[model samples]
Target: MLQLDLKTTVFLASIMSALMSVVLLSAYHSFPRSIRGIGQWVAGSLVLVVAPMLFWLRDIAPAWISIVLANGLLLAAVALWTLGTQAFYGRPPARRPAAIVVVAATLAVTWFVYGRESYEARVTIVTFAMGIFFGAQALLVLRHGGRDFSARFFGFLLAVQTLVVLARGMASLFAGLGGQTLFAANDVIQTVYLGSYTLMDLGLSVAFMLVITRRLHVELDILSRTDPLTQLLNRRALYDAGQRELAHMAEHGGEMALLLIDLDHFKHINDSLGHAEGDRVLTAFSAMLKRELPAGAHPGRFGGEEFLVLLPRTTMAAALALAERLRATSSRFFGRQVADLTISIGVASVDKAEHRLDGAVRRADLALYRAKSAGRNRVEAVMEAAA
Candidate 1:
């Protein structure tokens, strides 16, 4: 018969709690800024308080101290639940007063029960209070923001914690109800319970760390491929897309058009209104281009005030018509406030018979120079010379 002592049980629980706290702290430091920092702090606090309390349980003369500590842990968990709800679901503070009230009531009940004559009453009250709190937190998270991965992940962790608490409560209840025989294999039962809880805790922590890492990676990827000022595809993305389009055209005999657009005297905007206003103008112009272009077309900010558009599966004539529409749209949109806020557009189409994408852009650049000479606010299509 393998008999276990209470001191050993408390020691093991303390060690496991401490280990979990360290793991969570490591995850918190490594987590992305996007994750709610408050949630991490709450988790860290819960582990810190509970672990030390578990170790001190034997030395404390009055059992009421342990009861108070347990209630305090639950209180911290409830506060964490509130912060998690706000961060994950964007919940208003006024929406869930019930949560706070329940936690307060649980704390009061736990304190009152600890002073009761019956040890069974104390055990039952504390166990049920913690279990209920965990379950409620899980339900709230699932109801409010279950769609997001982080919300669901937190909810799952809460649910598992609730189950662990419930199992502990049941073990205590059986012991109190004069069913000592039921705990004949108490050591085995407790070992299994602790093992399962530890595993769940570790799994949830690892998942959260992975989620934060992935979010950081995605943000970095977007920053690498996007222009910060205009919020458009940067030159690198544009060139890569152009190369891919050209390769597809070569393989499938489809046509694509490229339009290089330059803002006329954009330097005048910066000089007159400051760089902030210049940024606004560029952002507004980019938005207009995005709104005007067709679904298949790709637009990019090609450094400075220059922009490029790739029109896929379109003929030279269609490209010219699209450019004319864009020119007209810009004129109408910017006519009132920004005087002479005009653009010069040079259009070129893939000429599979004679030139490649780069050659076509060069020809378009020549036409663009011609357009500036002919006066801005116009579109020019490059006409290939005779072979």
Candidate 2:
């Protein structure tokens, strides 16, 4: 393997970062609109690459380009990174604060280029700003972003980067940083500082990609298990939960009951009030179920106009009362809008020996059918369901 020095490492790192940014930018365009902040990240990464390249060209470039322009772009990139971090987590960016910091950093650089030309002053200002913005990004990740390993790692990296950058800024004053540009570093401290910055670039890029991919996977899993309309667990998830609940009941002696519920006159509402109104009714009823279900109830959408709830450590009488409450609430709520809007509920106590969700559900479903036959707006028990 070829040996590399600080300058060579920085150069290669910049190139790699630029390449990664470009690839990510292209990928950002391909990502769904549901994923936020990719555009800001893409733009910020490009600006970030430009900052270092300009720093490297300090000897050849004009003071305005190297000092003012480079620092401005660097701060801009940090602002964008903060914004991107917020966006990735579906949170709003701290625009006013970021804008203030960017302006301050750029003004400090402008003063260095035009007035005092003091490298220490410029470095202090820029590094402090970087530390603050990096800290802000770390906060964003921990606050609203994913709690997965990759997300946590990214936040930790940002926190460490913040401390290091701030320490660099503080140490620069004591180190007698006279006129040392980023590239023309004479001491070990400057070289180490630059090296750390390069490593930060590499680490954050990899961490953020992992965070994005992991979050998407989590969201896809949720989408698969949940019904889009009612925001309830879908049939698969319901059955899965039922199976698990039964297993738990086998181990721990607990009474388990199933409630098979159907919206009464739902087809008529869809036909008379239109599908849009019917959808609203479904959503309202879903909200009601969420509010009215007993504590620790496992509610799921069984199918169209049908829902199931599993109640563990609950009696048939308690289940009946809860079902009655749901029916009364539904009647009072939907009755005003549509006269015949009501729900039929059927309760079936799961037999300890049966050990199956399907068998329990079948009994509850028969009870539901009985409720439908006997005037459509009442609760029926297991025996009533059998008839």
lDDT of 2 by residue, 148-185 (tens): 78988999999988988888888886776766657654
Give the per-residue lDDT of model 1 (tens digit) for 102-172: 46655665555454444444445655666765676677767864366765786788788788768767866
What TM-score, to 2 decimals, does candidate 2 have? 0.93
What's the lDDT for all of these models? 0.67, 0.83
Candidate 2 weakest ten by summed lDDT: 1-10
Give candidate 1's error at residue 227 in angstroms: 0.9
Model 1 stretches with alpha carbons more than 4 Å out: 1-61, 78-105, 108-112, 115-191, 247-253, 351-357, 383-387
Indicate which candidate wins on TM-score: 2
The residue pairs in collision within model 1 are: none
